[model samples]
Target: MNAVLRTLVVLVSLVVAAPVLAAPAADVDLVKQRVAKVGVLRGEFSQEKQVAGFKNPLRSQGRFVLAQDHGVVWTTLKPFPSEVVVTRDRILSRQRDGSSRVELDGRQQPAMRSVNAIMFALMSGDAQALAAQFTVKVEAKANNGWSMQLSPRSAMLGKVFTGLKLQGDRYVREVEITEANQDVTRIHFSGMSETPAALSAEEGGKFE
Candidate 1:
């Protein structure tokens, strides 16, 4: 994938932990109560992107780590080995040979700073933060399962993302992102865990 597409994938992967809720205040509280709060969450993910005019969707599978205090580590192991790490200050990507590149520097790009804040809020299940950006519609299901649809509220965000749909019970299981150009990306998360409650030494090194 090109750098811009790769960056979009990284952003989608980081928000997999977001809580799905309705626009109503009570529903927001209800959804928050249902989602599991943890300092660290790790999982495996499979993503498929359906680009306009492409007959087949592009697919990739990988693993991800979300640390509330640190940031996210997304490792793409198929098709090619690569990794993307997002922290408060910047977004970094690594090649299989250990070469690292700064994808975005929040200090220099004010827009990236906002993106970083949104990412952190999503992963941390900050419903209020989400509500400020997207108009959310939620459906409650049996067994505490629920689903939500989100549309960007700002003109800037709307220029890129058309909408998003997310679903889960205790954790977000699926996410579908629709772009303005009609390209759609679907992501499924599995093997999620909160155990270990901390990053491994090697994983921690990626942030530095």
Candidate 2:
């Protein structure tokens, strides 16, 4: 697979999946309702990747800022620093040396235009947008928390992912992606805060 496509798949897989939601319609609605309340979210994340035949999992920790209408600034702080900025129109990756590496311009490639759509949708907790791509199943867990399992409907994605799961309370807390190649990536998010005001100057610059 192409590296860019692989990146897109990973980003999209973080949010969208297929299959069904086992919970009742009302419960699903409530989940969506709670998720929609988040606007500006800042958090820290720990990501673990387990690959087939690998002796140990690859792990990284990062900070992320998600502006519902703008984009996402994902900054990895440990295990090799890097940053990725995803907007509605493009995806930009930068190395630790402050040099640009990959830039995917959605304006140039029509297909890439939606690169961040599902990702933002997931971050925004839009169940309707998620249902368009994945067969969704929702589970209401204890302590006001909820879990969702999604299976891919697209054959292309099915080749890469076997299943995807998300869990959270008022805000999304974790994402688990299981690939067909016997690999998995699990991201746990913490220290999340939903800001009452708009994005700051530094945060807003990521989109540009």
Candidate 3:
């Protein structure tokens, strides 16, 4: 994966790890109830990556669409234009003019299955699926807000990420990822909406 694609994957992976709140089943249920159940969600994001030795964090802004049972379309609009579409079958990166930059087939890359499973679970708020892979701790915040801390359960995942933190009210508002090398990435989501309730024709076509 290229730098942009790798960053996107890390973002998605951190999201997938968010639901593993280690609180009681009732607490988890409360979080589930608080999250909006929508077929389609659209939002804007600002991301910052702080490398171990860098004095300044790399920043980028973007928009994203998450379609239930379909996939995610992430379009980075600043620091250069690019798009990454991730579906169950493949991960495709496209250039500014819409030419394919790279593609990874799920059949050829077994890891794609895991990535897809996590991505879908994150989009759907599937706590059980996420809890299976991470050690989670959840805390209920005021005004219907909640926060979670996650640590990888297996050594393999641990090699990639040391820990993750997520906070949100009705939807995920922020995610922080700490990689094994001590680099950190923080993502904030804004302008979230469930309006339209379904993907538009253009958005739907990206999944294909």
By summed lDDT, the worst window of 10 consecutive residues in model 2 runs over: 17-26
Per-residue error (Å), model 2, residue 86: 0.6
Residue 193 local lDDT, model 3 = 91
TM-score of 3: 0.87
| TM-score per candidate, chains pooled | 0.85, 0.85, 0.87
**Full-model lDDT, candidate 3:** 0.76
**Model 3 stretches astray by more than 4 angstroms:** 1-4, 7-27, 122-125
Q: Which candidate tops TM-score?
A: 3
Model 2 C-alpha lDDT per residue in residues 1-208, reported as the tens digit of each score: 2222365846444333333333334346857766646568899999898888999998989898988778888888888788888888888888758764777777775545444766776665666666665677888878878888877756656777788888988888888888888788888989988764589988888788
Tens-place lDDT digits, model 3, residues 1-208: 4455785466445544443334234346666777787889999999899999999998989999988778888888888788888888788898768655888787776557667766565544555556766766778889998887777876667778899887888898888889999999898989999998888999999888
lDDT of 2: 0.73
Higher-ranked by TM-score: 1 or 3 = 3
Tell me the deviation in Å of residue 41 in model 3. 0.3
Q: Tell me the lDDT of model 3 at 63.
A: 97
